[model samples]
Target: MKSTARIKQVLVLLVGVIAIGSIGYQLIEKWTLFDSLFMTVTAISSVGFEEVHPLSRAGRWFTIALIVTGRGSLVYGIGALTAFWVEGDLVNLWEKRRMERQIAALRDHIVVCGGGETGRHVARELLRTRRPFICIEIDSTKEEAIRKLGEGMLYIIGDATTSDVLHRARVEVAHGLVACMPSDKDNLFALMSAHELNPTMRIVTRAVAHDAGPKLLKAGAGAVVSMATIGALRLASAMVRPNVVDLLDAMLREPGATRVQEVTVGPAVVGQALSELKLQERTGVIVFALREGATQRHVFNPSQERVLQAGDVLMGCADTEQHAALQRIVTEG
Candidate 1:
């Protein structure tokens, strides 16, 4: 049975025993309510206090029964209470240990610093993509909120700027790190620590101040995002190109809507012409750009005659089903 249920049962049993003892004293000893209650408490507690008045044979027998039943119930109730407390502690300890072991076993996972607004959004997107990630937040409340946001999310409670905390998140084996702490200084510190720990890992950070962007990039962040700048750009875009903004919004809100995506060219596609692949006709995917693997240059509105090469990244737009077909053709071919 549940510990709570057991506790309630024990309490009920004790109360019933006390009521029975008091009523027995009143009837068998012919005493007043106060005297009977006092006698019953004394007997149950085993205090050895003298009785209020001399007891008859029946009253003495009644007292003996109350003492045995009351004492036994009290001991059992106390024991249950103690077990409940110890069991709760043990369960918490076991869960903590299990979580630590799971974190230690993760690799190629994303590490997110802070569980603030930006960090929460980042985590949500990662979760949608079914990516493994660990979030570090100093505030207990935010940590709990993030955990509630997603059951699979992993988190640690500590300052992200600290090396020990970063190490605990296994930054060295992580595929990337997102620094979205509220303060620019904290984000910068965390970015630098993550970069130092894993130079090859991609580090993306949020800059609270516009001027901090350059400093964060110099500090080893691969990308530094400014919410203010993005919001400003978005505002301008809404005014200047309402139709374009509407299209983008529709893509975001509608399930299976076509959106721009990228796919890397594999060995099988090398030396093949765009016309031969006929991606648009075959998969309903429109290719917009080709990023050359060798020169790292982009060829926008690539021609049908253009020859596909290994290591080239194709940028295109397609619906859910078309996107899957395009991915299979690009990677498999």
Candidate 2:
């Protein structure tokens, strides 16, 4: 910010000096506007071009003052510019601008707050799923780690709980946000701020404590997950149902590998029986579980005679290409 301010200040001063010099020449020497401008440019730039017209006694003194002031300003401006370059401020500024443009161009992207382990994992999953997203991390030290999440990663280095930072991340156009701040309060604040900025966007917040889940939910977070609780559950599952755990692990272990996904039944596929779609045969997407549109309860291994309705969610397993085909036919058709 200091570097940016310095550059702005230098530019403003230079412009003001040039303008004043041009007007001075026009008045004192009675030169045309073009001649005055040319004289001013040459004088300020130290080109040492001859005078456009013979100078009066007043004009000579005015020219001397202008030369001294112009040279001083140019020297100061050069020093500031050199500092900006040597400090790498110029490159940083350019990259920040490019990132902002990329972020602004996004639609339906996800915003991930924090650059800790949780946020890192979430970003990796979003990357593997091919979702366009941006991250906001307050700690400057965490910036390098965040950038290493992928090539050309989009992120903001600022407090995510603030509305200004969220706006910078384009919360208004985002489809979802993941709040994974280190503390429950920070995550809660981010969730509320994000909701205020984009009421329709789905928000999932991390719970630092097991009991914070309900509070986050009441605060308008679409869902809340406790890392400790999930870890405990996974441990128990690994011991009691190792095979099932292994299967789930295998599904998520690699990019383009078969994985389970939940997609809402779109209007085009609504009212159609499972058998009529032949989803497995057509797209290799098997619909194994159905969440009824009205009931919101899962019916595992629903019969072929079951009909898909609006707002119903289907959970199925398929590889990347197969899932894309399934989404195009059912969720996007």
Candidate 3:
């Protein structure tokens, strides 16, 4: 808003100076409109151009006043413009508007609450999955750093545990939301607020307290990941299954490498069989498991004869290009 106000102020001052000079020239010197406009431009610009015609004494005094006033306004306007660009306000304003427009146009997208360490990791994973998401962060200072986590990142600086902020993120149309606020309470509140705004939205929340998981789940979170529990489990796995851990970690961190991901079966392909789809032949995507749409049960190493149902999730390993193909097939049929 400050940047926009500065821009408006500069434009208004410049227009005011031009109007005053142009009108004074025409009335005092009895000059043509074109000549008056030219004199006004040259005088304000300090271009050192001669007057269009000889001037009366009154016109001379008017010209002197115009030059003085125009120079001051021009200097002030230039300073404002310089500050707008040099201080990064111009870029910030542009990015904010672009992010807002992109978020508004999105449907079936993800909303990530917070921009802390955990939130940044979630954002990176979402980017890897090629999902459209807008992050809500309370700290405006962290916005630029969070945006550096991925290209085309959209974000808003506002409290995530509030309904107004969630509404601004278009939560009603969002497919899922991840609450990664600093505290379990903040995450729980955000989960409930988002659920209230869109009851059908699938929410995954982060919990730090040992007892907070149950409360978060009860408060409308579809899933709650306790950071301590996961950390302990990960440490155990790394100790016992070092090779397995390294392989999985390498696959996840390597660019353009095959990684585990899930894609929902769109309604258009509800009755299709795995053999009919031939995902490997068409998109080079491998489907190793099918999560039933009705019961949410997992079937590992699904056979070619397995028929897909609406909302059935396919878990597989795919690279970026193959993942894009799978997403298109699932979402666009």
Candidate 4:
């Protein structure tokens, strides 16, 4: 349980016990409920108030019992309140404000929704790449688990489906959003909310069900990857193409990891081809393939005859610096 909830529970239990004890005293001692409650409160608080009436033998014994129980409850309640202020309520509020300030200053950062296995993996990759990002998780336990693998990551403990949480995440300024919540419905909802918040924002998500791709896309996801299907394909590839699988594993584990990027054609590269671009010669990068409209073509060793178009996407292997250069060449052209 979170400290806040636990403290609330303790306080409520104490209040209930005190209420019941006061009511019992009123019934047995023939005292008004208010008087009985006031007597119990003073005795428990050790406030040294005068007695309401004379005490018979039975009343005297009852008073003794009430004093012991009431005093203990009073002390316990005060301690719990003190601890709540010091450790739970005030601290959480302070952290929340600090996180908000940090998020407001972020730009070109990724927003991750959910902290499940897939989300965690995505976060780890972002951390490894030293990218700026904020994670949103509904589950406290899962949030704790992700925090354990800390890399100065920021997190907001709330549902990503809410506009308030997205706003706090600085969605309008974020470069992209990754929705990896467990349910396809949740991921789709989060994508929709994020897109509505920032129309031009890039959103990538995972769908639990294979057929949920179209729905997720309609909900504003730029890319919807199905984990189930991908897992199946990975298993099949590992069995039939062990060497290929091993190569991929090695690429991920090695330092200076390689990532495949799609560089779009920019104004400056209007009439340029993969061969003419000379990315390989200039940046030690390779153009693996090219896409124009609905067609994809492998241009491992492209010829100068190929012309670049405004909307064409180039698939290439490169590092961060090369990728940035590719972006500059395509967009700033």
**Best of the candidates, TM-score:** 1
Most lDDT-accurate candidate: 2
Best-first order by TM-score: 1, 2, 3, 4
Q: Candidate 4, residues 1-333: lDDT per residue as tens digits?
A: 566676777778668767876886777788888888887777667778788776667777777887787677767767777886788678768776877788889998999999878888888878765679999999887867887767456988899988899998899999999999988888877888889999999999988887899998888888889888889999999999999999878766666746777787877887766577777777777776777733654455455567887677877777677888878767765
| Residue pairs in collision within model 4 | 266-330, 268-333
- lDDT (CA) for every model shown? 0.88, 0.89, 0.88, 0.80
What lDDT is reached at residue 78 by model 4?
74
* Range of the 10 consecutive residues with the lowest summed lDDT in candidate 1: 250-259
Cα RMSD for candidates in order: 4.6, 12.6, 11.0, 8.8
Task: Return the TM-score for each candidate structure.
Answer: 0.73, 0.72, 0.69, 0.67
Task: Supply the TM-score for candidate 4.
Answer: 0.67
TM-score of 3: 0.69
Give the lowest summed-lDDT range of ten residues in model 3: 252-261
Tens digits of per-residue lDDT for model 1 on 1-333?
Answer: 888899999999998998898888888888888898898888888888998899999998998898999999989999999989999899868778988999999999999999988888888767654668999999987866887877756899999999999999999999999999999999988988888899999999998887998899899999988999999999999999999999988766564546677888888888999888889888988899999999999999999899988889998987667777888898776
Candidate 1 regions with alpha-carbon error over 4 angstroms: 4-73, 141-143, 232-261, 274-306, 309-311, 315-332
Going through the candidates in the order shown, the clash numbers are 0, 0, 0, 2
Ranking by lDDT: 2, 3, 1, 4
* Runs in model 2 lying further than 4 Å from the true structure: 1-91
